[model samples]
Target: MPLLVTDYSWTQTDSTVYINVPLKGAKVGKVDILSTDEYVKVHFPPYLFEAFLFEPVDDDKSTAKVGNGVVLISLPKRTNKEWDHLMISTNDKEKKKVIRQQALLKYQDKLTSESRSKAEKKHAEKKYALETMMKLEKEERDTIQKMKDTEREKTTAELAAWQLNQKQKAEVETRVKLQRQRSRQTQIKAVTEEQENQCSGEGNVCKSEANCKKKQVVLPAPRLTGNIQVTFTPRVFPTALRESRVQEEEEWLKKQAEARHAVNADTEELKDLKEEHRNPDWLKDKGDKYFATGDYLSAVNAYNLAVRLNRKIPALYSNRAACHLKLGNFHKAIEDSSQALDLLTPPVAANAAARARASVRRGSAFCQLQLYAEGLQDYHAALKIEPHNIALQADIEKIRDIIQGTTADPDTQ
Candidate 1:
């Protein structure tokens, strides 16, 4: 049997009752409290306190606070009257047992109801989040469809205009050709008539015919020929010739051209795209615009198309890696960044910035995946390219601190 708490204090007003029970250094966490209109119980391990009120009090309006080595309970009276005692003076054990069972049952039912309410609230929140995601997906689809339709309309209009212009040009050229033919025929006939009249008037048919024939057979002037200087524009990469590897650049260009031509325009996604939209450069710009606007999914879509059009472009893969990073697709980001780094070869000045960016993006993805050692290597590579970058230096220091177990929060980056 537990020790009974008897040295408790109580005070009352016309409508309220306040009870104070000393905890004897008991922790708040270890205290179990239960209350009802007719009964109250406080259980603390080896000590127990029970109160059976003399008159009914409103449990619904009651409050409890546990602090400073005490448990304080405030109970409101059901009727506007003073309670003569904190507990009822009773000797019947069966009556006390019956009240305690009833209070326990009520408490269990209240707990069940509260738990059900919390579950319903959590379920509602999940449903709302799912619905919001679906709505956003629908909106994105609608926007992409609108863009496709607009591009299709514009391409159609341009094709129609070009066809009409070509037709008009052909008509003009046909008319000019016909006029020149007619003028030449008329001139030949007039010259022939003049020659015949001259032959008849001279009464020397043979001589006149010979003269006319001689004039017609007169040799054309000898063609003037001179040396014609020919010059060819040097085919080279965008970088300065002195600083560039011509062979590698040429090979890179050849690969890019092949990649651009390799796109299967007959595919469902590409078949309906405008000619301009099929260009990797245009798609890259589109992706950049979407990224700037915080539409990472759309940006990824655009970059995907660009990569399909020309897989050799490092910037396309690098930029798409950024979109994947923002979307939290860390693995995909790492893949794209690695591909970009692979394409940014020769380690020249022209590609130094691109290589640095690819390295940093890959490092960020690796760090996000908790591959700190691999991430550190990539960060170091990027820092080498931009040694004076303070932000990059700071990031390197943070990563080092994380690796050394000196960082309080590894997830700070």
Candidate 2:
């Protein structure tokens, strides 16, 4: 016996690698596909096809499906790189072993038959064995597939029956609920009419009114007028006027004390405020240092100080936006980026660069927040500023694919 090799074809694109192998008489459970980051192997009977790629692939994203007399393998590339070649090497080593096993299984019984001579018996046995094996393999595959189909049909029928029963139950419950509601309304109307008839007589009233009147008590009117007069003397005064004058003096004293305390507190605060550093450049430098050290919170504080001192500096807002973006504060990043864009005086080279950086950071934050449309708009704006950046282009493409349910192939796009 000799080794056998089955011919196959493959194609590659920027994001995917596709391989199609013909399986004319293949059976389920007889075909196996093994894949890793660097290699792919397909084992089917006497054929064993292996491929070693030039670079790694995303094995988790790859898939293989057997249908239409073909095994189609789709490999998603880990990175957007072109494949120089399909496979590095191939091997087929199990041909003789498989043939010997089949021959022994099929011809062992025929070897003991007595009607025919050895040569003629051997020839007939070989032909019958091959045909019988093929037939058995086909029948086994058909039986397995038939069982799967039957199970699927059973599950579908059960689901449909369950849905129909739920619908009917809901309809019955709805009807019962409507009937109960109508019965309750009729009962209420009858009770209301009986109450009206009972209350129709001059001496009759509702029990609620009787209870309400029972809980209320009438109060008597005052007999004397509410009047009082006060006069001030040198040492003595009316009782009411003296008490009122004392209360006014105490309130004035308390307010004077509070005002003095507040003035003292303001004086101390003013001293601290006068001593506090107010240089915008120094604050921006402190923020830059904090950002470089990955202290985003501290950097944000420093940037806030700088912005308070000088609101016209666009770099302060853009730099702070980066820190906010890193900290997962997407709303703050958008606000800061919008501020940077607003503060830009004109579209000079430096201003354009700053705008592009702000836009990219804002776009990335928007994507993290799942606001794809706004993210796309910011990304397009960034692209216009830095049109030749490959990384930005790839990001735009990936974002588009994500928005489209991961179906848009980068190469095709």
Candidate 3:
């Protein structure tokens, strides 16, 4: 039998020996095995100062080495407990089934990993396509908007020119009319004065043909007769069309603002949902933030959803209980603290500390329900176990003060 030289232990229940050994470090740095029905040989590389097993049964294979001074020891698999656990009894009692199971599990894991990778690739492709398409769409929209702006600018210039021309034409027509009126007035005044002068020469105006003829002196030149023409100017140019275009542009701007705001809000909502749904801690943080903000109802909702995914938490239940207390739900506070006490198993020191906290919190809840005696007992028990706990000491002092006043009889007063 091989000498058990390593740190290993064996327990004999009846005649069979059960051995538990750690195969780690350089011992497992290399492994090779070959087996027949009666025996198995395990080879190990050197730098392996000591190889551990429950105990190797064959003495001859001990210290056997390859050319590089590595041990090639063989042991009977029947004697190894872990190996035995891995073994299955049948007409062909062998550990082949465990190997097969492990292989199948590994293959399934690989398949699942491959499937996830494919899904991720597909999503990446889709996202890339969506981004590209969005870029193109934005470019197209910008181009169209530019064209519209250009058209609007061109129309505005045309309207301005038309208005300017109309004003100039109006001014010219006014000037011409003024000149004609002045000339006519001047001619009438001259004729009237001349007639008056001629009439005054005889102390009265003569109506006789010979007197009229004497008064009507011959003009130096005969007045030319000409046809007078008139032109009408339009009051406005591109009148109704330009006004309608401007109104349309204003409407389009309003529509664009509304659309952009809606899209931005939707994108923000989507981003929040994605980040929250993927990680549970994010939701918990949000709940804590809400609680900090004094929005107890919103905090309750957020914490409740986070707890649904993972219930193995002490802080979640404790904080939720705090929220319940603030909301005046004493029964809910008791229930949550109770659940927290049941679920949490912290490290020894942490567990002890948490025990005192839970006990004190429950005691407060009990006191709110007027279970004063039980509440006081729980507080005393916590203080006794953790004597130096300052917070507990404070609570105990407050309770003592309350009791000192309450215990005084009315008759004493």
Candidate 4:
């Protein structure tokens, strides 16, 4: 007879193979399955599935159960060993069937035979029982050994992970401490340079810290004209005494003007006559370009324009907050980040990343401002959104360290 073709799905465990095949509208009696130690064949009307076993199975223990719209075949392996694959191939179906039948007959005949002596039968039974008990004991020992091995592997993995975490934490703490020390040294160096610049080339050297802080032009109180004090330009003050102060004030004003001008220029460009330039996305991109180039002032300008154009956009505020953070405008950074947070609604999937970034930025600004309590709160909130962010965790630890250090410092309170 010719073999029928069928489509099926199968899965295997340690000792059993399960095959499921579609057999809609077919009765259970119509489904026939033949099993052998080395092969299995299934027949259901127009469909047939056959495969050479990857290993031997106990044919008598195999079963086929049909229900709903499917036929399920369960094959029991003769030994407790695992099969490497489901089957070797789809060949030798006829030859394997003949061999399986002969084996089945021999097994049945052995079961029914009465020619053996009573002594021999008792010995055979006892031998079978002893083998069964040894097999059970071996399986129990194997199970216990496997359980111990798994637990040991688990402990080793956990230890490795803990060691990695500890190493990373130590590195982060060292880096943060070095950064703090460097920042302090830089501040001291800047102050020394400024003092040197103020005192350089002057014939009258400041003899003490009090003199250095005192006004060089210690003029008498200005004369009042009808109860209104007259205000004169720095030029009216003594030239030798006022020159440095006047120049410093002028330079400071000029820098402020340049910064304001740059912002105004960026906003004006974003708001140009071209309609395309007014788009929020275009303005945001422009801001990003400025930020990338380290022009945070101009970036802030662009982001301001973008926010004005689309106040509802959360990203505009978040990006603006980042620029503010870079520019050391902590107050503005906090304000913009708060705006971003307000715009970012709950069920964070919609803008989780944006919300997280905004939180980190706000937290950093708070940390810079010495508001560790608030900064720690923001960091914790950000962590809820990205629990596995190593950098965020490091920041949280740094903030906690700051809090602890501040609490311990006598000067801080």
Best by TM-score: 1
- Candidate 1 lDDT over 172-282, as tens digits, reads 999997997788778777777877776776665646445778645232476798998999677654323533466767788999888777654347667898999899999
Candidate 3 lDDT score at position 181: 71
Model 3 lDDT tens row, 1-413: 11222543434432233333333343443433322222223323221122222333432232333333233333434343444322234433344334433433443354456667998999999999999999999998897678678888998999999999999999998999799678777876777687777666666765665765565434356568999899976543233335546766668778999999998876676465665564558877887899999999888887786686578777778778878878988888888887877776643566776666666777788777755445666687578769888887887656543332222222223
- Decreasing lDDT order of the candidates: 1, 4, 2, 3
- Deviating ranges (above 4 Å) for candidate 2: 1-276, 407-413
lDDT of 2 at 212: 45
For model 1, how big is the CA root-mean-square deviation? 23.3
Write one digit per residue (lDDT tens) for candidate 4, span 285-335.
998999999999999888877776779998889998898888889999999
Clashing pairs in 4: none
lDDT leader: 1
Please report, as a residue range, the 10-residue window in candidate 1 with the lowest summed lDDT.
404-413
Candidate 2 global CA lDDT score: 0.74
Model 4 off-target regions past 4 Å? Answer: 1-272, 406-413
Cα lDDT, all candidates = 0.83, 0.74, 0.59, 0.74
Give the per-residue Cα lDDT of candidate 3 at 273: 61
Tell how far residue 13 is off in model 4, in angstroms: 74
